[model samples]
Target chain A: MYTDLVAALDIGGTKIAGALVDGHGRILVRAQRPTPARENGDTVMRAVEEVLAELTASPLWGRASGVGIGSAGPVDASAGTVSPVNVPGWRDFPLVARVRAAAGNLPVELIGDGVAITAAEHWQGAARGHDNALCMVVSTGVGGGLVLGGRLHPGPTGNAGHIGHISVDLDGDLCPCGSHGCVERIASGPNIARRALENGWRPGADGDTSAAAVAAAARAGDPVAVASFERAAQALAAGIAATATLVEIDIAVIGGGVGKAGDVLFEPLRKALSTYATLSFVRHLTVAPAQMGTDAGLVGAAAAALAKRTDAAAAGV
Target chain B: MYTDLVAALDIGGTKIAGALVDGHGRILVRAQRPTPARENGDTVMRAVEEVLAELTASPLWGRASGVGIGSAGPVDASAGTVSPVNVPGWRDFPLVARVRAAAGNLPVELIGDGVAITAAEHWQGAARGHDNALCMVVSTGVGGGLVLGGRLHPGPTGNAGHIGHISVDLDGDLCPCGSHGCVERIASGPNIARRALENGWRPGADGDTSAAAVAAAARAGDPVAVASFERAAQALAAGIAATATLVEIDIAVIGGGVGKAGDVLFEPLRKALSTYATLSFVRHLTVAPAQMGTDAGLVGAAAAALAKRTDAAAAGV
Candidate 1:
């Protein structure tokens, strides 16, 4: 089979997206459907099927050698299943098997959304050419993935870089994930907004209280808002430093809404990094903004699919 | 060149040890010397050379294919240099090149001591069958290494899993490494003893004030000593759990003096782990004592040499 393309799927709580991507990561056809997140598992699965149906109907589908899925985790690549926390209807859902069946028995590769984004970054964005890196998303929730020895390290369960859940403050606040002082609890967008509000940073006339609003306020010299962002930066710096110390990543690529805060996040992050990344090997680590846009998930899925196809070909599968 | 043995050197501040190791990880011949740690760099080099010379004089030296050194870090495997903190006399020393020349131009492999111990454990001890694990030493200072995908992850500079310096409490005590609230600052043997003494725990009739003595006091139900051990356990648990959460390790193998505290350490460690390792993938992580003893560094150095030799052979080098 001289297949030159792969089908990619990016499944999240809000949407099910599908695409036929070439070796160069160019999408030739696309499909998407709103996720019935609160509906039954079957309905959510049906939305995914509808998106896959559209992709299968495209002429580009003929060149797709395999199917790649980057889904909201926790995903079990070993079991080919996913049970994303936001999508309660899909507990231990057998996604890979269903996608494989829907794609005419094509081989399937699955990874967490964070891992998928890392794949995209490593393949074509900020992490490109870096042998070891950490790529993170700090929007509604903090999530991340890693590249080790120049390859994506999805780990045994496809969730290697769960930095958000790692405790940076052992005795701080409890996270919904059942851990205390998690990075997400301190650095995520919602948490940033919450902290700013708790510190008496009232919203503007429009009453916009998102982290973006906080960033604007910080830009306008609001001390309380600035302090909130600073705290979030400290937590993120601690987490990033911890990751580098553990695995020797030379760069951390930050993405998502909160990452878009620009200097409000990066300046404080760099300063705080010096406080935590003190080891000789880790002291030289750098942080950067992510380059890939919303299409990161699809492109990253394609990268993984291509890698899987190459591996299978090497094994003569 | 059908070599069946490799020469191994385990270099630290206190001692320099060498061995001729077989393919099965057995030490067939050995040599040792005290490190003149405070002397000039040449003196330290001389001690290492003496140990290597003894190994080279052994009858089994004829079968040695390469030389491997597991040295107190920070080691730069890429630069073939080392600058161990306790051995200040040898900064950026070209130990690998010297060892290679000393070993009759044989290939040389170098790794950090923590990584070396991890290799030993993964090859023959606590982490033997696990594909992913973290092996730690909580002695005078904390140190650790990782086994990922069933291989020792020595990382680019040969220092990957340096979990001791990771901050589990972002706003707590300042660490000598310049980081705040590092695991070593809270959980190391010296730190444990320091905390116990600072909290008003009196020394015994022998006036011993080591972490081992604190462990004994805790074992005998001394409240202050117990509290100190519990605190150390909490820090270790947070560090270990963070490692597991980030890298998906199924087990954490702890060694060194504090690890010998048995229930005094492991009991509270397991309890605190439940508080931090709350992610679905990390919830099942286990903790165990290292099976490899003082010779772990030697055996692990041998393991790296064997791996290097195998890679060379496979590449037709």
Candidate 2:
């Protein structure tokens, strides 16, 4: 059979999205379900099965040679399991095997959502032309992925770029990850909102205390909101510089809610980067907003699937 | 002639060493010269030429197909230039071209000294069996390199794993590299000695104020010295954990002066690593003393040369 398509599943705590993607990374069929995250593992599995059923129902599914999953992680690609912290019922869940069985035994490849996003960015977004780059999602949580030597570097466990948890301030506040002063602790959307509220940045008539609201206030010249975003930018810059120093990335592509803060986040981020990325090799590092939008995870997953198919074919498997 | 040997040059601030090494990593000829680092760039180039001349005098040199140079960096392997921090005479010096010319137009490859050590470690030392590892030199100024997916990851400019400059404390004291709270600023040999001295720890009878002296004091139950080493260990741990979190290294091989401090450094380092390496993928990351000794740089440079030759052969060049 001529297989020119691949199946992709982007599984998160709030949603289970499935799609059949063509060789050109276009989605020909799509399905999604609000995750029953609070339910038992089996119920969550059923939701995934339903999504797969919707995908399998499409005539395009016949062309899918393999399945690729981009799930909220820590994903153990080596072991084919997923233990997403937000998905309480899915600790060490055999996601790959279950998904493979549900999808008529198609070969399955799995990676962390951060790595998947990187694959998307490297394929057709901000990191497209860069051989070494970092792609980040700064929403309620800060997560990231790396591209080294022009390929996605999803380490052995598919979680090589968990930048959020790396400590930038060793003696700073203890993070929920059991680390002190993690980038996510200071730069995530929730953290940005929390810091702003703690520092007397009040919400308007809508009573919205989200980071977006804080960014709005910062845009309007609110000192407290601006300070909070600046602090977040500092942490993000330190983490980004640390990443660039360690792996020699030339660019960092930022996405997600906090990344949408535009100049408020990027200006301070670029300035703080100058403070940390002082080495000769890292001095040229640049930051840009991500181009991949809502369907990044799906497209990234499909990219992984296509890559696996190519690899298998190359190896004559 | 059947080419089975590689010529290696290990260039540092204090010395220039060269060798003709066989495919089995055994050195068949050796040469050395004290670096005229304070002299003009031409004089420094002459010293390197002198070392190469000595190696070329040996009959074993006839079998060498390529020459590898491992210099104190920042080296631009892509541009064939070097601007080592300690060697002020060389600023963007064309070391690769000069060495290639001096070595009878042999194919030449250049990498940082830290990367050379990592190649050595990955080829025959502590990181030999581990596919993903970080090898470091915690000496006067800390430096390091990485092995990813069982091969050396000498990023675009040959300085990927320069972990010493990565910030562990974003707001801490400034480093010579113009960064704040870099690992080298807190965990390097000089920093350890400086911190101990500033904390009112008096040198012993011999008045040795080096990090080795501080390690001796820490071993002898001096509280102040112990605290200094502990602080240095904390910084090293945070940096190591950060490296593991970013690139998924399974092991970190420590060497050089501070790494020789044994339990005084390792004990606190392991304790602090548990504090920062909280992610599942990085939690299993282990720290070990580097197995390659002073000869590491020479061997590692040879390893790079051999690798280059092998690659060329594979590509039918």
Candidate 3:
């Protein structure tokens, strides 16, 4: 049984989330602070320290062993540096070392938030008990992590489960990754909205409507809305089926805000799988909505620290 | 340095290969014997014992510490039982315990041949140094092993790299595994030859024809032969490109007798990849021929044993 507490941190585009979690994967104390955007590494480090200090000051932080930080894209966990594409300020940031510096000299574990989300699913959510599966979040931007063969697959660059970048439409739109027809470009929220807007489906006749609103309209008999979401769902499912085929993943966990579309998204996606499900081994592959909701990153960060503590105890290191 | 040696065995439909390999991943002696048709598990075990004894009697077998066997499909590695579909008379055969008994108490390891081949590729083949790739042998039946994110992936049933079974066409063809549109069912060796034979094409006008003969005929201006091979190539390429998109594999190595179609296959396969690569990730993927040739299986068997022995040694068991 787990007997120690861990420091879990989530680094986002504009904020940092920190929490002290018990061995049973429970959050004891939590703190959140804005990231020092456009600032140098020292400023960002100070922000993270402040966030961790806030949690450490809590009486619940007693006996905590180490820290785990989850950051955004293009991260390198092997080197414990974050190279988030959206936050250029974090290019090659020595995140683990920085967290360790303020963590009373305990070990620091850094991983991609997507990877953390996947691990969280493995440790506490939909992907539990399945050695090979994917946790895909289709929100502001699509991000995912892979749990393959009972182990997390954080690539040499810590970008193993970058499914959004997978191509589903060769002649589709261009993606931010400089690729044409990426799943993200053709299926993410922005793409969905862009397609809807272009096809004359106005959100409040052009308001701040999200993909959820579009899904609602689709269900309410809006043809353009249905068309856009269906198209996105089709693209995502094709990519998912392809992943399932290649990795032999038994299940796919879809998270993020867009997943609330539920059947509106899943039905078309399943149909796409049916179209591509000729392979007996890969057919009838399951896709489900993620269970941990917005807290997946937090749960995953805790899991990473918990894993290190577990490993250390096992190794007697 | 290799302080221990393990006898490695590979059981395939066509051949049963055995090798005496040291712990350092080097093979000291290697030999092969054909697998008899409809040979039951008991008979195969007898052949296996003979092969092991021949190797153990050799000078290279002096240091072998254990035995490891990698066999064809539907095998239960955990229980050491084989239920290979291609090799009849093996109904839940206790292959592991049988091999262990034959080894006279040597530590035993059993896994899928795909896993072994992938392990071999990781240890010292085309996939070496590259963490995310797939090793495929497109012979009698298409089989594969996956190396994802710097580690080998063996699914819950130890069948993660069952790439050939992924459905490429829903209404395409029926596979032996009771699945329709499997990559293997559509594009594998027998299927390729069957397509050629069923197409009513003369193999270069009165030749004792096979797939290779048909390829020759196609090269020599047989319209039907060219179309048959092209269709097979296209299906295989679609499967390959789809895999690349999902797994982000940098390279895929094609082996087996069918791969002997050479440019006749690769050229059209690459063209299909170019045409059907929905994502840039897939489009840029590399497909190559396996470098280790027939030695791959034997080497993979060695690699599997190496992992087992090394893990045991590290565990201080």
Residue-by-residue lDDT tens digits, candidate 3, A1-317: 34578889988887888888887778778889887777877877789899988977988766788888778866767677887766767778888787887887888887778888998888889999887888998988888888876767655555567777755544455566654466787788877878888899877655766787788888898999888988888777766766775666788899988777888888888877676544444665889899886667877888877787787888899
Tens digits of per-residue lDDT, candidate 2, A141-254, equal: 999999999889999999989999999999999999999999999999999999999999899999999999999999999999999999999999999999999889999999
Alpha-carbon local distance difference test for all models: 0.94, 0.94, 0.75
Query: Per-residue lDDT tens digits of candidate 3, residues B75-177?
Result: 6665678777777877788888877776777887777787788888778777888878888878788888887767666655555677777655544466776
Instruction: Kindly provide the TM-score obtained by chain B of candidate 2 when compared with the true chain B.
Output: 0.98
Cα deviation at A95, candidate 3, in Å, is 3.0
Which pairs of residues collide in candidate 2?
none
lDDT of 1 by residue, B258-279 (tens): 9999999999999999999987
True contacts kept of each: 0.89, 0.81, 0.20
Say what the RMSD of model 2 is: 1.7
DockQ of 1: 0.90
DockQ of each: 0.90, 0.88, 0.21
